[model samples]
Structures are given as structure tokens and as C-alpha cells.
Target chain A: MNGFGYLRPDSVHEAAEAYAAHPGARFLAGGTNLVDLLKLGVERPSTLIDIGRLPLDSVQELSDGGLRVGATVRNSDLAADPRVRDRYPALSQALLAGASAQLRNAATTGGNLLQRTRCPYFQDLDKPCNKREPGSGCGARDGVHRDHAVLGHSPQCIATHPSDMAVALAALDAQVELYSTAGTRRLPVADFYRLPGEHPERDTWIRPGELITGVRLPAATAGAPSAYRKARDRASYAFALASVAVVLRIQDGVVDQVGIAFGGLAHRPWRARHTELALLGAPATPAAFEGAVALELAHAEPLRDNAYKVPLARNLALDVLNRLAPAPAPA
Target chain B: MTSAPQPGHHSEVTLRVNGKPHTLRVDHRRVLLDLLREELDLTGSKKGCDHGQCGACTVLVDGRRLNSCLLLAVALDGSEITTVEGLGGDGDEPHPLQRAFLDRDAFQCGYCTPGQLCSALGMLAEAAAGHPSHVTGPTAPSGRPVPLDRSEIRERMSGNLCRCGAYPRIVEAIEDVIP
Candidate 1:
């Protein structure tokens, strides 16, 4: 790894100020992704602002019954929290489905959201990747793109965000809290990510010197029956080939409310707004679930090697939804 | 920013490794794995992939398991670290996991054994603390003791790769010592 400057900040203000002072400085929490990228030469920051010791490690209850998850809260601790496990099982399950026990123990929620895509082309400095270096070209678009994005991708990039926790958060309608030199602000989890558009280099809309403070999970959808399921090359310790996170609430045999998000198919968490729109107020039937899922997958324009992801995503979404809200038996 | 440390390429850190404290100057880019192996002269922790993909450099930091290769040494100041050497009992007495490994023939090349042992130790603690794995049931109660069945052991220890393919024996060794 290249030699760099390090500064351990004590508070959020200090951390933000440190970032503003250094042009290309990065905030290091767990260092699970950043350090690995440094070793691969994918990332080179001249300075690092260590924010692991900040007092933002608690998962507290908001006045409106929502959850305020501190940025530095480790993935393992957050997944094991009683409230998360019982109230929001999908979030807990998503966290467990990602990485390993060791990684979950060290990875932080904020860092997980900020992790880069696992595109081999992006990691290999020898390859040309628009996401790594804009205008350099996208190698994944033409070579070894079986794991590349199948939805919401552009000619400039075909990378997929690899955070299972972020996918679940999008389905749960969580909001990302950001602190900057000007002030603090909150953006919906779905809005926090960018769709790779023309500027694939900018993964998120976050501005420079902005620090992610925490995530706020609203209570409206917290108690719904939810789940996260992934189709991977292996049973565990592997990235998702396609995954779905579903939050369903059926009332009187009708789909009263639902939130859905697809991962490993897009630059960001592909929140299935169209699917949710079709599912709302409809009979919780197998046919309805199939139609809703098909409505979302219709937008997918899979590449040569990744045409299988379309079917994989459809099956995963249907499976999770059907299990969460089964059809009524024949009378 | 004024309250933060002055920007420098190196910093002095005191790390408590294997029950002993060592104070030294480390480059900001130096990872904890290098510090443990090179600076401390404790070669128990092996660097297989040198990245987070392979778990050969797994260690316990403040009682939690993490890939030491991904952790910057300067960032781990004032933290307690435990390597494979520290997992053993005092004075020639082997740790129960070590004894179980020997009895079960848990390793062939033994290069990944250190990381496997430390990861197993951390996995056990996590399960005891009600941490769930991917294989865990969604309906399982939170904060309840998780039953470390064969599947749980395999899933929890999936991060450690045994290139020697001693997985069956490794699983047996870990399962044998679970109370």
C-alpha cells in the first residue's frame, strides 16, 4: 500500500473539517473496502480521516417510533440488535447474508453503503473501466460481464452495487443522514445512489466533504412481514448473482402495502416502484405476484453473458413475495 | 480539524498483542497483519491472499474477529489483538481447539490453520452472543442462544479457506469442542 497521512478525529465536525481540508481525503471507519482497494491500487487517497472512534455507534429509537442507526454501528451488532431482528427481519437477514462473520464484525453501516462495486474490471488497474477512470472505457461491457449490471446501466458503465444491507434499506424506506460543512440533511435511501447515467465515476450524489452520519428507518413499514433472498454461485461467502428484498403487508386478503428492491442487477438498489404499484390493493394471489414481477423485469436489457440474471431476479422476487403473502387455499 | 492529529505519513501506536504491549512507529499504510508478523516478530498469523478475500490473516481485535490485512495499524491504536499464539493455554498446554484439531486431523498444509483457529474462536463468541448467520432461521428469536449445528459451523467459518481441503475435519474439530 502507498504511504498516506492519517488523522483520527474525535467528533463529526472534526471529521468533516478534515475532509474539507484535504482534497482527496477519505473517511476510514472499518477499512474493509477502502484498505482492500488501496492494496489493489483501485483507490489512492493522500490522507485518511479515521472516524471509527466517533460516538455514532448506537441504534436508538426516534420519537416517531423509527430507528436511528448510527453510522459507525458495526454490521454484526446492528443485525443482532433485538429491534432489528424482531421488527425488521429483512434488514437483519440481509446483513447476515453478506460477507462473513469477521467482515460483519468490522464493517460499519455507513461504510457498507459507500463500498464500491466488485467489478473485476474496476479492481484490475490494468483493465480500462469508466467507473474507475471516466472516459478511459468500460471493459466489463464487452468482456466477462456475467456479473455486471442487467438493469439501469449505461454504455459508460455496467457495474452493480454489492451491498446487501443497502438493498434491504431501500425496501424498508430508510433515509440516509448526511453531515457536511454547511449543515446536515437526509435523503431517501433510494435517492442516495446514482444510476450511473453519463458519469459512472460518481457512484452516489454525495458531495465532497460530506460525512454520512447515520440511517433513519421509518416506523411505518418496520413491522411488515419482510425477507431477503439471494441467488449466488455458492451457498455462502459469495456475492449475489441476483437478490430481492421484500416488505409485504396483506390486509383482508389484499396487498395493503409493499416495498421491493432488487440487487446485483443495477448500479444502485433497484427499488421496484412499478411492481409495488401493481401489487397494492390487488388480491394476494400467485398470478398477481407473477405479473407484478414481470412488470419490473420487462425493463431489464440484459447483456450477452448476463441474460440469465433476468430470470434469476424474477424467480427470487416471486419466491420471496409468495412466501411472505401466500394465496388463500381453495374453499 | 484542529483537534485532529497533524497530518503525517507515520504515527506512533501502542498495540497490545498476545497479552503484551508494544509501542512503535508505523506508516499509515501499514496494515495490522504486517505489524503483527514483521514488527512484533510473531509469525503465527500468515498472509495468504494479503487481501480480505482469504481469511489467513484473521485475528481478534478487542475480542472481535476481523481481517487484520485490511486494518491499518495506525487506526488500531490502543486496541487489544489476539493471534493464534495467544489462543493456546499457558506453558506447553495447547488450546482445546488445537487439541481437537490434532485429534481430528483438521489440517494438512497448516498454513491457514492459524486464521481458521482465530476465526473459529470469534465465531463461537458471536453465536453465543446471539449473532445470526446466513443459514440461521429468520424466525429464530433474537438474543437467544443459537444452536451451532454442523451447518451453522460451516456457514460461520466459511470465511476461512482451507486450500488443503481439510474442511470436513475442520468442521468436525470445531463441532467437537462446542459446549
Candidate 2:
């Protein structure tokens, strides 16, 4: 690992200023991913702004009956929070499904959101990865592309986002609050992550010197019957092969509301807006659910080895929908 | 841009490990696992993959289990850390979990034993604090401790991998100690 300057700023203002002054500096929260990247030589920052001890570790109840999760709130604490477990069960389940207990205990919410892709080619410094280097070729395109993307991918990159929490947040319609020297601003989670277009190097819309302060979830999406289902090679301690996060509300055997998102399938969390529209006011039946999923998946363009992800994602979504759907009256 | 600190500069850090405080000057890139094993001569915590993929470097930081390999020694300036060496009581009194492991014959090579012990301690603390696992029933209310069945213990301890396939005995050991 390369030696670098370490700064422990007392205030967000100071942190932002320090980052602005040092263009090659990076924020260090939890260090679960950043440290790994540093050791791998994928990231060589000149300085690290340690934000682990910052005053942003609380999970406060918003005035509007929502949640204001601080940036430094650990995954374990957030998953176990009563408000989160009761109101946002999918978020809690997603957090629990990711990584291991040890990683969760140290990983922070903000750091989880900013985590990089898990593509083996990207991590290997010797390999040519466009995401790692601008003009370099993509090794995963023709070599071990099984875990690559199936949606929102481009020729330059096909790496999928490896975050279960971000998928849940995308489905819950959460907003990311960012702080900088300019001021504060909020962006919906859907618009926060960028698809791997020409510039695969940029993962998120967060600009330089911008720090994620917290995430705000609206009260409307809370308390809905939600579920997060993941399909992986192993039962635990593995990234998702295909995962689905769904929030469903059925009334009188009809779908009144729904929120859907897919993980391990695209560069960003694939929000099923079209499927949500197709399910609105639609009957809560197997045929309707299948048709909705088929319509949403029609836009997917899977690579060679990753074609299996289409069915895996479909089955996972269907299972979650079945679990969240209201039971039919007894015959 | 502000002048960056030069490479090879050592930073002064103070860490409280196993009820003892130690101050040392170390490189900025020194990891906590290396610090404990090399500088402090606390080799109870073994390094497996060095990356966070393996749990052999698991340790308790402020009562929470985390991968010591992923944490920088300088980053944890004043935090309290507990390793496998701190589990047992003074003089020949072994901790209950350690005793249970011996009784159950939970290990073979024992390379991952220290991490497994520390991780189990942290897992029990988490379960007692009402943190639910993936296998916990959906109806189980949040913030309420659930029954520590065989499946719950297995699921909670899934992070620590025993390459010798000593899972059955490991589970038995943990089950015997969960009161």
C-alpha cells in the first residue's frame, strides 16, 4: 500500500475544503472497499480524509415519519434499527444479505453506496479494463463474462453494481443528501448512479469534493409489504448473481402500489418503472406478474455467458412478488 | 492543493488492546492486523487472505467484530480493541466459549480458531442485542432477541470458515455456550 497523508477533519466544511484542495484525495469511511482497492493498486490517492469518527453516525426519525440515516451509520446498526426493520424490511433484509457480519459491522451506509464494482478484471491491475483505464480494452468482454451486466451496459464496460443496499434504496425511492463547499443538495437514488456508458470510470454522479451526508426515505414507501430475494452461488458471503427488491401493496386482489428494482444485473440498480406501471391497478395474479416482468425484461441485452441472468432475475422477482402478494380467499 | 504528507513517514498512534494501552510510531499504511501480530507480538490473530474475503483476522473493535486486515492501525486512534488473547480470564481460567470449544473438539488445524472464537463472541453479543440474522423468522420482531437454534447459530457464524469442515462440532460448541 502506498503511504499518504491522513486527515481527520472535525467538520464537513473542513473535510470538503481539504478534498477540494487535494484533487487526488479520497474519503475514507469504514475502509472496507477503499483499503482493498489501495492494496490492489487500483486506487492510489495522495491523501485519505478519515470520516469514520465524524458526527454523522445517527439514524434520526424525520419529521414526516420517514428516516434520515446518517452517512456513517454502520450496516449492522441500520439493519437492526427498529424503525428500519418494521417500516423498511426490504432495506434491512438487503443489508443483512450483503457481505458478512464482520464487514457489515464496519461498513457505513455512505461507503456502501460509493462501493466500486467487483469485476475480477477491474480489480486485476495487469488486466486491461476500460473502467480502470480510459483507453485500455475490457478483458471481461470476452473473458469470464459470466457475472457481467445484462442491462444498461455498453461496449466499454459491462460491470454490474455489487450493492444489495443500493438496490433496496432505489426501490424505496430514497434521496441522497450531499454536502460540499458550494452547499447542500439532494438527488434521487435512481439518478445518483450512472450507467456504464462511454465513461465507465465514473461510477456515480457525485462530483469531486462532494460528500454524502445522509439518505432520506419518504414515508409513503414505508410499511409496505416488501421483500428482498437474492440468488448466489453460495448461501452466504457472496455477491448476488441476481437479486430483486420489491414493495407491493395489493387491495381487493388488485395491485394498488408497487416499487421494484433489480441488482447484479446492470451498471446501476435497475429500477422497474415500466413493470411498476404495468402492475398499477393490475390484478394480483401470476399471469399479471409474469406479463409485467416479461415486459420489463424485454429491454435487457444479455452478454454471452450472462444470458442465464435473465431467467434468474425473473424467477427472483416472481418469488418476491408472490411472497408480497395478498393471499387469495380460501375456497 | 495543500502539500501532501511525504511517503515513508511514520505516524504516532495510541491503541488500547485487551485492557492495555500502547503507543507506537508506525507507518501510515500499517494495518491493525500487522500491528497486533508484529509490533505488539500478539500473534493470536492469524492472517489468512489478508483481504476481507476471509474472516481469520476478525477482532472486536469497541464490542463490534470487524476484519482487522481491512482496518489501519492509525485509523483506530483511541478505540478499544479486543483480540482472541483477551477472551479467557486471568491465570488458567479459560473463557466459557473456549472451554466449550475444547469440550466439543471444534477445531483440527486451529489456524482459524482464534478468529472463530472472537467472531462467535461478537455474534452472541449481537444476537443478545436483538440483531436478527437471515435465517431468523420473518415474524420475529425487531429489537427482540430470538431463540438461538442450530440454524441461527450456523447462519450467524457463517462468516468464519473452517476449511477442515469442522462445522458440526463448531455448531455444537457454540450451541453449548449460548445461554
Candidate 3:
């Protein structure tokens, strides 16, 4: 790994100043992703601002009944938090479903959301990845594209986001709290990430010196059953081949409210807004679920090696909705 | 604490490992796993993948299991770290988990034993503290002890891979030690 300077700022304002002072400095939270990227030579920051010690590790209940999770809160603690487990079960489940216990223990919430794609081409410095070096070209687009994106992808890059937690946050309508020298601002999770259009280097809307402070989750959907289902190469310790996060409310065999998001299928967490629109007030049946998913995926343009994802996502969506549906009354 | 190091300079890092404090100068890029193995000569924590993918470098940092390879030595200043060397008694008395591994013959080549033992110890503590795994059903409340059944053990230990296929014995060894 390349040698770099290190700074441990105690407060957010100090961190912002440190970033502004150092041109090529990167915020180090948990160091699960940043350190790995440094070793791979994908990232070459001149300095590392260690934000792990900041007093941003709390998981507090917001005044409006929502939950505010600090940036440095480890994934393990966040998953095991009582408020998170009881209110947003899907978020907890999603966090648990990701990486191993050891990784989760060290990975922070903000770092998890800002994690880079795990595309083999992107990680291989020898290959031409537009995300790594703009205008170079994309190897995954023509090479092993099995794990690439099926939606929100362009000819320049087809790499999919590898975060299971972001998918759940997208489904939960979570908002991010960002801070920098300019001041503080908030953005919905869905709008924070962007598609890889012509410039895949910019994974998020965050500017150069911006740092994520925390995330705010709206109140739980009362009486709604939510679930996160991941289909991976292995049962554990593997990224999802396809995953679904759903919060469904059914009343009198009709879908009253629904929240849907897909992972491993797009450049960003694929918020199934179109599918949710089709499912709302629709009959709670496998046929209806299938139609809604199909409508949402109608714009999907799967590559050569990832066509299987289309059916896998559809089947997973059906299974999730089926499990959320109310059981039939006894005859 | 010393001021932050300048670019391309080494920093003085103080790490408390297994009840001993050792201060050393290391580059900012030095990982905790390498520092323990090279600088301190505490080679108990093996480096398998040199990344977080493999659990060979698993160690307890502040009572929680973390991949030491993914942690920078400078980042762990003043943190208490426990490795496989700390699992036994002061003398030759091995920890109960270590003894159970011996009885169950839980290893073949033994390259991954240190990580397996540390991970198991951490897993047991997490279960005792009512932390739930993915296999635990959705409705299971937080802070409620999750049952350490066969599947639960397997799911929890999935991060540590044994190329020799000593998984059954490893699971048995862990099961025997769980109280």
C-alpha cells in the first residue's frame, strides 16, 4: 500500500477543514473498503482523515418518531439496535445478510453506503474500467458481465452497486445527512446515488470534501410486513446475485401500501417505484406481483451473461410478496 | 498522543495486545495484522488473503471480532486487541475452546485455527449478548439470545473457511464449548 498522512479529527468541523486542507485526502471510516482499495492501487489518496473516532456513533430516536443513525455506527451495532430491529426489520436483516460478522463489526454505516462496486474488472487495475479511469473504456461491458448491471447502466459502465444495506434504505425512504465546509444538507437515499452515465467515476452525488454525518429513517410502516431476500452464490459471505427488499401492507386481499427495491440489478439500488405503483390497490396474488415486477423491469436491458438475473429477480419478487401476503382463512 | 503524521512519514502507534502495551513506529499504510505479526512478533494471527475476504487475521478489538488486515495500525492506537496467543492461560493451560478443538480434531493443516477460535469466541459472546444472525427468524426480538443450534453455528462460522474440510469437527468443537 502507498504511504499516506493520517489525521484523526475530533469534530465534524475539524474533519471538514482537514478535507478542505488536503486536496487528495479521503475520509477513513471503518477502513474496510478504503484500505482495500488502497492496497489494490485503485485509490491513491495523499492523506487519510480517520473519522472513526468522531462522536457520531449513536443510534437515537428522532423527535418526529424517526431514527437517526450516526455515520460511524458499526454495521453490527446498527443491526442489533433495538429501535432498528423493531421498527425497520428489513434494515437489520439486510445488514446481517451482508458480509461476514468480522467485516460487519468493523464496517460503518456511512462507509457501507459509500462502498464501491465489486466488479472484478473494476478491481483489476490491469483492465480498462471507465469507473476507475475515465475515458479508458469498460472491460466488464465486453468481458465477464455476469455480475454487471441490468438497469441504469450505459455503454461506458455496467457495474452494479454491491450494497445490500443501501437497498434496504432505499426501500425504507431513508435520508442521508451530509456535511462539509459549505455546511450541512440532507438527501433522500434514492437520490444520493446516480447511474453510471458517461462518467462512472462519480458513484454518489457527494462532492469532493463532503462527508456523510448520519442517516434518518422515517417511522416504521405500521402493521406492514417487510422482508429482505438475497440470492447469492453461497448461503453466506457472498454478494447478492439478486436481492429484493419489500414492505407490503395488505387489507381485504388488496395491496394498500408497498415499498420495493432491488439490488445487484442496477448501477444504483433499483427503487421499484413503478412496481410499487402497480401493486398499490392491486390484488395480493402471485399474478399481480408478477405483472408489477414485469412492468418495472420492462426497461431492463440485460447484457449477454446476465439475462438470468431478469427471471431470478422476478421469482424473488414473487416469493417476497407471497410471503408478505396474508394467509387464507380456514374453510 | 502525537500530532498527525505528514505524508510519506511513519507514525508512532501504541497498541495494547493481550494485556501488554507496545509502542512502535510504523508507516501509515501498515495494517494491524502486519504490525502484530512483524513488529510485535505476535504471529498468532495468520494472514490468509491479506484482505478482509478471509478470516485468517480475525482478532478481538475492544471485545469485538474484526479483520485485522482491514484495520490500520495507526487507527488502533490505545485499543485493546486480543489474538490467539491470548486465548490460553498465563502458562500452558489452553482455553476451553482450544481444548475442545483438540478433542474434536477440528483442524487438519491448522492454518485457519487461530481465526476460527477467535471468531468462535466472539460469536459465543455475541450470542450471549442476544445478537441475532441472518438465520434467526425475522420476528425474533433484539437482545434475546439466539439459539446456537447446528445451523446457527454453521452460519456464524461460515466466514472461516477450512480447505481440508474440517467443518464438521470445527462445528462440533464449537458446540462442545458453548455453555
Candidate 4:
């Protein structure tokens, strides 16, 4: 609610230019997350660039048998889209498991991707958080670290990316299409989010004045069974304690292809590449799934309090993969 | 140098409330709830939690329900809105859900009644459109009575907080409106 300049750009290019022209200018999408953060004094952009009027709300079919979801596509509309749900059930499940109805109705696809961490220390200005204020000191390293990170930890920050949709996108190998005054480029979902290694302030790889235009997901086979399961403290409207998004293409009693991603366990969506490597030729049983999970959790470095997240994530990933086993052929 | 002008006293915002438009300037910091009650004199919408957590300020924006308290008056410049007062039968008659609430004595303190009514109306539409609540699954398409069951109702209506503990009667009123 702090006083700031407001500018409504008619186009994405114009929006990008407006951002570069002004320091601390933020592209306002649905305002579900940004506005609340602003109210909490977590963000104090000198200028507010309103991108609501921009023509980025469409969901189009890419020529390469993929989908280009505009940055402004609401979470609710994205989940309700028949094409997304039919092709990528993981995306649908992840979207449906996000905030409440009113929030999903207002949260934009691009906004959801770039949302700041939900770490309690980061949200509280009184606390010293490296993510919120670099070089200030990270209180979470020795404080209440229940929802802290389990992977991709630096000596500086230990915060988890609180996005459910991004987890599925990471496993699907989605690409983020962005626009800037310079030009346009596509960034893989894996590379989009940055770790807190040295400078935790830089959350994403978005350049100055660069606006996320849309996201493109390469279409998979018709029957590739994909799902996202999140284990939270409660049933609904809660951040995940641990979650997994798995897409498996099993054929002839062998795994043809697999994509595994973990959320609530890392600074970004933790793509379980090692787990995939361990499970490629392995049998499709709970034991094999269990064996593959070790490779994924082997690199996990738990904090003083969140050590349980390692086992929780491993079991959750195994459970998700176990559910993907194909049915036996009729005798 | 002159002092900075105080916000929320401007007379420039043109708001379209429940199909009717009004040209009024309000305090920049004054919430939409205050504007509806103090400025424009439309008081059906109540304010429970000034934050977005409560549904006491629930209102319809082009048929979609939102917490009006969280929305800025200036932000709603040209959107069509619907409050509890604007909903009913053919001119002056109350809507069926409104009648149901009255018949069942759905409210006690009645502070959060306005929000509960509007939320129920929107929840009904969601049910008709096959929108699944938390209790629903992706395996089935939306639309099968939505069950209108107790748990579904509770999940769908969690945004609205009722401190009066009038939940049982409220559920009965909502169940009475199932088509």
C-alpha cells in the first residue's frame, strides 16, 4: 500500500521498456501474490508496471505439438483446460493443488513461476534473512528450519521454492519464453530459477526489463501417465511438506521413459535426473523405486531441523513412481 | 516546500457497483469495504478480517466472487459488480438462497451473513460448472450433484469465517438450495 508510480503498458515490449526506464519497476500480473507482498512491505517497487492489459492471456497450440501458455493465463483456467489435463495430468494436478479458488482464479502463470520464497524468515522483516537482505545473516540456518531446504543449499540461504506448478513443469522440461527491449529468448524451466549460492536476492534469471511472455511445453505421447502428489501438513490450502511429479511411459513391461521432479525439498524444482538414470532399465517394483530414490536423496544436505525431509521426499517419490506401473496384459 | 497531499480524499474514482456507476473519490488507504459502506452507502458487504483471509467482504465481479476488502476502489474502475442487495427474484423479491437462509435461521450474530450469502451463490455456480472442491478428484468430470455434502460445503466455504458458530444451520441453508 505504499505510494508508488503506476504505468499500464499496452504491449509486452512496451512493458519491458518501461521497466528498464525505471529502477525497481515490477510487472504486475494478477496481483494475487505481488500485492500481498507489497502490503507486507516485503517488496517496495518504485514503479508498478501494470501488464494486465497486455495481450498475454491466450493459450495457444504451438506448431511443434506443444502448448504456449501466455503469462497472464489464470491458474484456474489453466487447470480447467482440457488439453493440459488430458496431455499433462501432472500440470493439472499441480495447478489444482495450489491456493484457494479465489487465488487460483487470480494467480497468473508467469507470476506463479517467479513468486518469492515463502520462508517465514524471509516474510518477516524483523528477522535476518539472507534471501531478503543479502549479507545481513541467515537466521534460518540455526533457527526454526522446519520448512527450509534439503537440497541445493549454500552457506548463505536455505529456502524452498514454494511453487507446485513449477515442480511439474520441471519434470515436463517446459521452456519459459520471455521478452525484453533487446529481443526474445526461451529459457528451460530448470535454468529459470536460480539458487541462493552467493546472492540469494536474485531469485530467477530474468534480466532487467525482461517480462515472461509465456511458457511452452513439448507434447509427450498420448498415453504418458503423469501425476503430481503433494504431502502437506493438512489436506487443502497448505504448502507442501514434500511432493513429487512423475511422468512414466512404460511399454512391454519395461520403462521406456521417465521424468521425476521434487518440490518442497530444494531451492528450486529439484529435477531427479539421477533417479531417472537409476530407474531407466530397472524393474518396475516398489523395491526398484526404493533403490532409485536413494540416488536422488543421496545429495540431500538437511538442516538442523529439516533432516526428516530427506526420507519424506524419498518415500514420496517412490510412492509416486510405484503408482505409475503399467497393468499386466490379459492372460 | 509544501506538505504532501493526503491520499484517500480524492474525488476522481468512477466505480460501477452492482450495475450502477458512481463518481466518487475516496481515501487512497480506505478499503473497498469502507467505500461501499461509508462513501456510497451500500452496506450489505461486511468486513470481518481486513486481510484477505475472511470472506465477509465477498462480492461478485462480472459474476466471479472475490474478497472486495482486498480489492482497491480505484482498481475496480469499470468492472460490473454484484452485492447481496443486488441479487433477488423479479424485482424486489429475494433470491431462493436468500429465502432459504431466512427460513432456516442460518445466521446468529449476522455480521458475516452478507459474505456467506454471496459466497453460497457463487459456490452454487461452481458446483453447476463441475468445479471440484478439495474433496473432489481429477478422475471424474465436474458435475454430479457436487454432492452438496457436509465436507464439500465446508471445504468450498472455508474462505468465509463465521465466528458465531452458526455453521450447522448455514450448511442446512446451502443444502436447501441444491438444484
Best DockQ among the predictions, by candidate number: 1
The C-alpha local distance difference test score for the whole of candidate 4 amounts to 0.81
Could you give the DockQ of candidate 4? Answer: 0.28
Q: Ten-residue segment with the worst summed lDDT in candidate 2 chain A?
A: A218-227
Clashing pairs in 1: none
Model 2 alpha-carbon miss at residue B61, Å: 0.9
User: Which docking class does model 4 fall in?
Assistant: acceptable
Model 4: number of backbone collisions? 4
Q: How well is candidate 2 docked (DockQ)?
A: 0.54
What candidate 4 gets wrong by more than 4 Å, as runs, is B1-12, B25-31, B89-93, B142-150, B163-168
lDDT of 1 by residue, B1-179 (tens): 11233357889999989889999998787899998888888899999998788899999999999999999999999999999999984578889998999999999999999999999999999999888888888778789889999999999999999988999999999998899
Off by over 4 Å in 3: A328-331, B1-8
Misplaced by over 4 Å in model 1 are A220-223, A326-330, B1-7
Per-model TM against the reference? 0.97, 0.97, 0.97, 0.91
After superposing candidate 2 on the true structure, give the runs of residues whose Cα lies further than 4 Å from its correct spot.
A221-223, B1-8
Taking the tens digit of each residue's C-alpha lDDT, what string does model 1 give over A252-304? 78999899999999999999999999999999988999999999999999999
lDDT for A114 (candidate 1): 98
Backbone-clash count (model 2): 0
Worst 10 residues of 2 chain B by lDDT: B1-10
Q: Cα lDDT of all candidates, in order?
A: 0.92, 0.91, 0.91, 0.81
lDDT for position B85 in model 4: 82
Q: Can you tell me the CAPRI class of model 1? A: medium
lDDT by residue (tens digit), candidate 3, A67-117: 999999999899999888888888999999999999999999999999999
- Which residue pairs overlap in candidate 3's backbone? none
Give lDDT tens digits, candidate 4, residues B9-98.
233667677778888765443456778888878899997766566789888777777777766565565677788888873388888888
Candidate 4 residue pairs in backbone clash: B8-B26, B8-B27, B8-B28, B130-B142
